[model samples]
Target: MTRMKELRKKKGFSQVRMQMLTGIDQSDYSKIETGKRNMSFEQCRRIALALETSMDYLAGLTDQDTPYPRTK
Candidate 1:
């Protein structure tokens, strides 16, 4: 499974719930998750926030699941 899908499932969030959280349409989110579409930087940021994970982890840049510290 893609890291995004894995994290979303780990958080017990459905695609509908993801839409509610990230303002991304469920169908579009599904496409993003299934690799049928690409997410923009803003979308990635919103999704990372909603999933409580870091973009690095989502992008496979890091194996750590923890989010990085946020700056003010």
Candidate 2:
């Protein structure tokens, strides 16, 4: 599975549920998890917030899932 799918499953969120949390359509979110589609910066930010993880982690830049402390 891709990193996105792995993390989503780890969070116990289905594509439908992830859609609800991130405002991304289920099909679109599915594509993202499957690596068939790319996410925009805003989408990435929303997904990171929904998953409580770093954008870098979601982008496969790092293995660590812990997010940085919020600045605001």
Candidate 3:
């Protein structure tokens, strides 16, 4: 699975559900998850927020799922 699918599944959200939350159409969401489509910055931010994850994670820049890590 691609990063998009992984993130969405980690949040237990279906493609339709995620699309609804992010205001993206279901078809578009499917394409994104399958890597057939690219997401805009705004869309990426909305998806990250909707999934309670960080943009960095979605973009494969980080392995941490959360937006912020707990201080040790």
Candidate 4:
């Protein structure tokens, strides 16, 4: 499973709920989670935000799941 799917499940979110949080359609979200579709950068940002994680974590670029330091 994709890290997105793993994170979603860990957070107790279903595809429908992920869609609701990410503003992506349920079917599209399912495809993204299942690795059938590539998500755009904006979609990744949204999903990361919704999951309270960093884009790097979602993309598996880093094992650390904490978001980067926020700057105002």
Candidate 5:
């Protein structure tokens, strides 16, 4: 699954709700989540902000996906 879908689920955000929060259309958001559409860096950043996740995590560049790192 794409990071979008994973993060959305983790945040308990539905497609419509996420779209509303991100000012993106539901269909477009769905496409982005499915990787059927290419999202811009700004769009990804917005999603990361909305999901309370880091851009690196959203882009799968790192395993530390959570917005806030867990304190040991």
Candidate 6:
């Protein structure tokens, strides 16, 4: 499974829940998960936040799933 999908499942979130959390449509989220579509930077940021993971992890740049501390 893609890192995004895996993280989503690990968080116990469905695509519909993802839409609610990320403002991404379920169909489009599905495509993104399946690698049939690409997500914008904003979308990626939202997904990472919703999934409580780092964008670097989602991009396979790092194996660490823990997100970095956020600042205001």
RMSD values for the candidates in order, in angstroms, are 1.0, 1.2, 3.5, 1.1, 3.9, 1.0
| Top-TM-score candidate index | 1
Model 6 has an lDDT value of: 0.91
Better of 1 and 4 by lDDT: 1
- Tell me the whole-model lDDT of each prediction, alpha carbons only: 0.93, 0.89, 0.83, 0.89, 0.83, 0.91
What ranges in model 3 sit over 4 Å off?
Answer: 69-72
- Error (Å) of candidate 6 at residue 6 is 1.0
Point out the worst 10-residue segment of candidate 6 by lDDT.
1-10
Residue 10's C-alpha lDDT in candidate 4? 90
lDDT of candidate 1 over 1-72, digit per residue (tens): 299999999889999999999999999999999999999999999999999989888888999999999999
TM-score, cand. 5: 0.84
Candidate 4 local lDDT, 17-55, one digit each (tens): 988998999999888888889999999999999888999
Q: Provide the TM-score for each candidate, comma-separated.
A: 0.95, 0.93, 0.84, 0.92, 0.84, 0.94
Q: Per-residue lDDT tens digits of candidate 2, residues 9-31? A: 98999889999999999999988
User: Which of candidates 2 and 5 reaches a greater TM-score?
Assistant: 2
Would you list the rank order by TM-score, best first?
1, 6, 2, 4, 5, 3
TM-score of 2: 0.93
Off by over 4 Å in 4: none
Give the Cα RMSD of candidate 3. Answer: 3.5
Q: Give the Cα error of residue 40 in candidate 3, in Å.
A: 0.1
Q: How well does model 3 score by local distance difference test?
A: 0.83
TM-score of 4: 0.92
The candidate 5 region of ten consecutive residues with least summed lDDT is: 63-72
Query: What's the residue-level lDDT of 68 in candidate 6?
Result: 96
Measured by lDDT, the strongest candidate is 1
For residue 62, what is the lDDT in candidate 2? 88
Select the stronger candidate by TM-score from 3 and 6. Answer: 6
Could you tell which candidate, 2 or 4, scores higher by TM-score?
2
What clash count goes with each model? Answer: 0, 0, 0, 0, 0, 0
